[model samples]
Target: MILQGNDPTTGASFTLGNRLQRQLWQCVWLCLFRPSPRPLHAWRAALLRLFGARLGPHVHIYPGVKIWAPWQLSVGGHSGVADGVTLYNMAPIEIGAYCVVSQGAHLCTGSHDYNSANFQLVAHPIVLASHVWICAEAFVSPGVSLAEGAVVAPRSVVTRSLRTPWTVYAGIPARPISTRTRHGTAPD
Candidate 1:
């Protein structure tokens, strides 16, 4: 018998209609979003909003940021997604007010179930609490929650929830190393 190449173990995947809808959205993202001129944050935000993203005032989504499923995203006021940040939100992703997701940071909410024969799709929501800072190129895994005022150091890989508020985390499988008490974090 010839191999059909279809995985039977994956019971019920994305239907034809769902695939088509995603294709349409991809086209919109490629045509209208990827080509949008730089620094026009308002335009970008408006486009995301049109796509059903719940964004508060002053939410800055820079050009070149890839937002998969904007409808599942929620960004509070004064939050920013810097250039080249990829928010792969197969599940919901909430960025609270006063948060900054720096350049190249990747917030991924989708993963395949390794134990499943068909490698079924699975997802978990990510929550970045208020006043948090996800530094450049940080990789935040699915189901991770960065507490309020938490600081993820540059290039860190956060695998689990950061429960303590106001702490600095660094290194792979990020570990909190210090308590962050910033009284005006500005160059003196």
Candidate 2:
């Protein structure tokens, strides 16, 4: 399981150490990461790496991107997370190589179970396969996995996995809208 404490009534959702680390990270974000210039993608990536994020070479994470729990994040080579993107990765969020997450996009990996009496906290991993493109302001929900070359239209919401590779999806529920031509093979 990606999450630990389900019931907040029993105790805090995260452990004390986790909470402390988050606090420290928040401070660093405010003081260093957030204030850095726009062109300093490597600097921001280094900061995220310090927090335990597994990022490959040439990954571009803009200064305005908000990342919750960098430890649970892994972004592959040549992936670009644009400005105003939010990665709410309560669980692990693995982004494959050559992916583009456009500005204002949101990837969420945690939610509350409304059916549960205690309002249990549940989380799942989000995986974006290589060559995936999430357009501006798109929302990818928990447990979603976008196949290789999948494209999510702007402002669309994805609840389930997009199983078909090289397809484009749009609308509230993000149904398949069109097909895209696949490019080269997997990167070395």
Every model's TM-score: 0.89, 0.93
Name the regions of candidate 1 deviating beyond 4 angstroms.
Answer: 1-12, 182-188
Q: Weakest 10 consecutive residues, lDDT, candidate 1?
A: 1-10
Q: Kindly list the per-residue Cα lDDT of model 1 for residues 21-93, writing each as its tens digit.
A: 5677788889988898887888888888888899988888887888888888999998899989999987899
| Cα RMSDs, all models | 5.1, 2.0
CA lDDT scores, all candidates in order: 0.86, 0.92
- Can you tell me which runs of candidate 2 are displaced by over 4 Å? 1-11, 184-188
Give me the candidate number with maximum lDDT: 2
Q: For candidate 2, which ten residues in a row score worst on lDDT?
A: 1-10
Q: What lDDT does model 1 reach?
A: 0.86
Query: Clashing residue pairs, candidate 1?
Result: none
